[model samples]
Target: QYRLQYKMTVREELYRQIKAHLDLIGINAADELFIFDGEADAEVYNRAVKHVDLWNHNVEFLEQETPWERPAVFIEFQPIKWKAIVTGVEYRADVFANLHVVTDWNEGDGIGEFQLLEKIHEVLAGLCGSNFMEFDIDTSMTNHNHEEVVENIETYHCIGFRHLK
Candidate 1:
C-alpha cells in the first residue's frame, strides 16, 4: 500500500468535520488510502478512481435532489473543498503508482521506457480513470541544471483534477 498526503489550510472545526467524514469512509488519519491484498498497481489505481467517483456522485446527488435534508450549500461547501483535496491526493497517487510500476519494470533502465508508457495508457483506458494526456522522463541533466532543465521540459494535455468536475 502507498501512503498519500495532501495539505490543506482551513479552520480547525471544518478540518475536524472533514476528517471525521474521511474516517467514516475508512480513510486513515495519516491521509493514507490503503491498497489491500497486495493488489497489482493497476488494481490499486482503479480502486482509487472508484472511491473518488463514488464520493463525487453521492455529493452531486445530495446537493441536487436532497438539498433540504443536507446542510446549506455554504456549509456543505466545506466538505466539498475537502473532497477536492482528497481527490487531488488520489490523482497524485495514481500518477506515482504508475511511475513506480514503470520504473520497476526494467529496474529503472531506459530500455523499458516505452513499455512503461504503454502500460500507463492501458491502465488509464481500462479504468476510465483521470486522463494523463502527456508526461516526460528527463535524463538529460540532474538537479544541478535546474534552470537549464526547466527550459527543455515539455508538458501537454495535463489537466488538473479540479477541471474534471
Candidate 2:
C-alpha cells in the first residue's frame, strides 16, 4: 500500500512538472491528456496505443481540450513494473515510467511534432537525475500508425525504499 502511494505521488509530481515545462515552452492546451494508472494491466509497448483507443471524436471533449492546440502525451507504467530488492535489512526499488507522445504526422510536415517532442524530452530530462531517481530514456522501441505516431520514452528510478515506505 505504501509503495503504491509513493508511486502515485511520483506520478502526480511528474504530471505537474510536465505541465510546468510545457507551459514554459509556450503550450497551454493538449488534444488528449491523461496520466494513466500505471498499475493497469497491459503490454509496455502497447499501453499508449491502447489509451488512444478511448478518444473517439467527442466534440465537447475536443472543444474542452484540443490536441491541435498541443499534442497529446500519454503517461503510463511499464509492464516490467516496479520492482524492489531486499538487502540485509534495507529495500531498494525502481519506479518504471513509460511515456508516449502522440502527434499528427501532418502537423507542420512533422517538424512541429518533432520539435515539441524534443522540448518534452528536455523537460523530462531536467526533472530527474543521478541524485536518486535515475531518469533514463529508452527510445529504442516505438509505434507509429495512421495519422498518429506514438513515441515511447522509458524512465527507471532506483532509490532507497525506506524513504518511500
Candidate 3:
C-alpha cells in the first residue's frame, strides 16, 4: 500500500538553497559597493556572511537593539497555496517570498546596501533545487525603517512540488 509522506516544505527548502548559495558566494558588508569601472562585483572577497535567516515581517523587530550583524539578508514567505495533483499523492505549491537586504547606512552613503542587493538578485533570480523551480523577481523597492540601517526588499515567486509513494 502507498503512503503519503512529508519530505520538506517549499519555504524550508528555498531557505536552505538561498543560504547555501549566499554562503558559497561569501558576501561581506565591509567591501566597497562598486568597482572602479562603475559596476558591482559579484565576487568581491571571501569574507564571512554576517547574518541570513527567515524574517518574521515585523518592522519593530529591527528597531530594538539586537545582535544582528550588518549586510544581513532576511527571507520572508507568504502563505503557500497547495493543490492536489492527479498523480497519486502528489501536490503542487505556489510560493511567494520577499528578500530583505539590510546593510549599514552612514552619512548619506548606501553603496554597500545597493551592491549587496544587486548581487543577491543576480544570484537568486534563477535559483532552482530539488523541491522548487526557478525563482523570478516580481518587484523590488527601498524600505526605510531603522535610522542606522538601509534595506531593499525584493519580491520573488516560484512553483514547487511534493510527492509520496
Runs in model 2 deviating more than 4 A are 1-8, 27-69, 79-90, 129-132, 140-142, 148-165
Q: What's the ranking of the predictions by lDDT, best on top?
A: 3, 2, 1
- Poorest stretch of ten by lDDT in candidate 3: 32-41
What residue pairs are clashing in model 3? none
Listed in order, each prediction's TM-score against the native is 0.19, 0.50, 0.77
lDDT of 2 by residue, 28-100 (tens): 2342222333334222212222222122332224446554422455566543333445434434455555555
TM-score of 3: 0.77
Which of candidates 1 and 3 is the stronger one according to lDDT? 3
Off by over 4 Å in 1: 1-110, 125-165
What 10-residue stretch in candidate 2 is worst by lDDT? 45-54
Best by lDDT: 3
Per-residue lDDT of model 1, residues 14-34, tens digit only? 323322232222113453343
> How many pairs of residues collide in each model?
0, 2, 0
- Deviation in Å, model 1, residue 84 alpha carbon: 18
Q: How accurate locally is residue 116 in candidate 2, as Cα lDDT from 0 to 100? A: 59
| Model 2 TM-score relative to the real fold | 0.50
Tell me which residue pairs clash in candidate 2. 31-66, 31-67
